[model samples]
Target: MSETPEKSAKASKSSQAAQPAATDKANSAAKPAKPAPKPKPEDKPFAAFINDDLLPALKQSLTERHQAPISLELVEGDRPVVGGNCWMVQGVLPSDRRFWLCFESDSITSGKTIALAETGSDPSLLESFLIDEKRINLALLQSRLLQRLNGQKWFGGN
Candidate 1:
C-alpha cells in the first residue's frame, strides 16, 4: 500500500533528523579523545649544584681552614656545557695570604671544581689562567692545592 504524499513527507523529515543524531552518536563512539594539557617549562637542573650545594660547601671549607674571606663569583660567558661557567674564588691561604682560586670549566671533573692558584699579581690573572689551556687540568689543580696547603710543593705538575 502506497502512503499519501503528506505522510510520506513527514516520514522523510523524521528519518533525516534521526540520521543526524545517529551520525553524532557514531562519531562520539568511534574515538575516545582526551583533552590536551599545556606543556610545562623546562627547569634548570644545575641550579642547586651551583647555588645551594657547591657555593656553600666551598665557603665553609675556606672559613674553617682560616683562609681569607673566600668570595665566589660566577664568570659569565659562553661555555660548551650547559650552565658550565668558570667560578672565581678569591681567598687567602695559611702560607700565602693573598691568592685566588679559579674554578675554570676545563678544570671541572666529576661535578667538582679543580681549584687553581693565580700565581702572578697581573691585573688580568683570571683571564691569563683561562687562556692557558694546559694549566687547567682538574687533577693537577687538586694536587697543587693539596701540596700548597701542606707546604710540600710550590708548583703544580702541569
Candidate 2:
C-alpha cells in the first residue's frame, strides 16, 4: 500500500529528526567533555592559597637564595596581636633566624603584618606591609619576604 502525501511528509520529518539525534549520540560517545581547570592561587581561599601555592613558592625561593632548606609552617590560632583567630606563616632559616608573616584574618582581603627575630631573641623587627592585601599573589609574597630579609642583612649584603 502507498502512503498519502501527508503521511509521507510526516514520516520524512520524523526520520530527519531521528537522524540528528542518532548523530548527536554518536558524536557524544566519541568525544568526552574536558574537566574544569583548577583555580589559581590568588583566586583560591586564603588558607588553600597559602598551603598550596604561597608556601611552596616561598620555600623554594628561600632555599634557592640561601643555599639551604628553608622550613615553613602555617599556624592558625587566636593570636594576641589580632585578638582573634589568625593565620601566620612561620619560617625558619638554618642560621636559627625566624620570621612570622601574620594575617589579620583568614582572608586575602585582610591586612598583613610581619616580624623577624634573630637567634635567641624576641621579635625585634615588626612592621605592617604597605601593599594592598587584596592584590597579593605568590610572586608578591616572595618578593616582599626577600626584601624584608635583605633589609635586615640576613643575606649578608645591602
Candidate 3:
C-alpha cells in the first residue's frame, strides 16, 4: 500500500531540516583557510641596531677611549617604550671594569645626530669620568661616538 498522508508529511519535514545541516558542512569544507599575519618590517632593522651596529660601535668607542675592550649584555625592561625596542644595555666597560648601563634613545642629540649608545651607573663610572677638574667630558665622548657611527648601516645611518 502507498504511504499514508501523515507519514509523507513527516518525511518531507525531516528531509527539509536535514538539507540545511548538509549545506552548512559542505560550505565550511569548501572555504579556504585564512593566511598567517605578517610581522612588522621594523623588527629586523631594530634588531640589527642591537646586534650589528650599535653594540660594535659602542665597543670600539670604549676601547679607543678606555684603552680596553667593552662588552654589552641585554637589559630588557619590564616593557619597551614606544618609538623603538627595549635596548637598555648593561655591561662591563673595558673588560672586568665597573658595571655600566646605557639607556637607548633618539632624543639625546649630538653633533651629526647619530643614535646615542652610551652607559651610566649610580655615580660609579660616571664619577670617575668627572675627575681632572670636572673635565674628561662625557658629551665630547658621546659626540665622538655619534660621529663615528654616523655613516654605518642601521640606526638609519645608511
lDDT of 3 by residue, 64-100 (tens): 6543444565454521212334334444543243333
Q: Is candidate 1 or candidate 2 better by lDDT?
A: 2
TM-score of each: 0.32, 0.68, 0.31
Cand. 1 Cα-lDDT: 0.45
lDDT-superior candidate, 1 or 3 = 1
Clashing pairs in 1: none
- Write model 2 residue lDDT over 5-108, tens digit each, in one string: 99999999999999999999999898777888976678988878898888888778777777353678789864433346678888888778888888888876
State the lDDT of candidate 1 residue by residue for 15-120, as single tens digits: 9999999999999888967778643221223333445444455456556555534355444343322334545444444444334444444224323322334344
What would the TM-score be for candidate 2 when compared with the true structure? 0.68
Task: Please give the ranking of all candidate structures by lDDT, highest first, separated by commas.
Answer: 2, 1, 3
**Model 1: lowest-lDDT 10 consecutive positions:** 39-48
Q: Give candidate 3's error at residue 70 in angstroms.
A: 4.5
lDDT of 3: 0.44
Error of 2 at 66 (Å): 2.0
Return the candidate ranking by TM-score, descending. Answer: 2, 1, 3
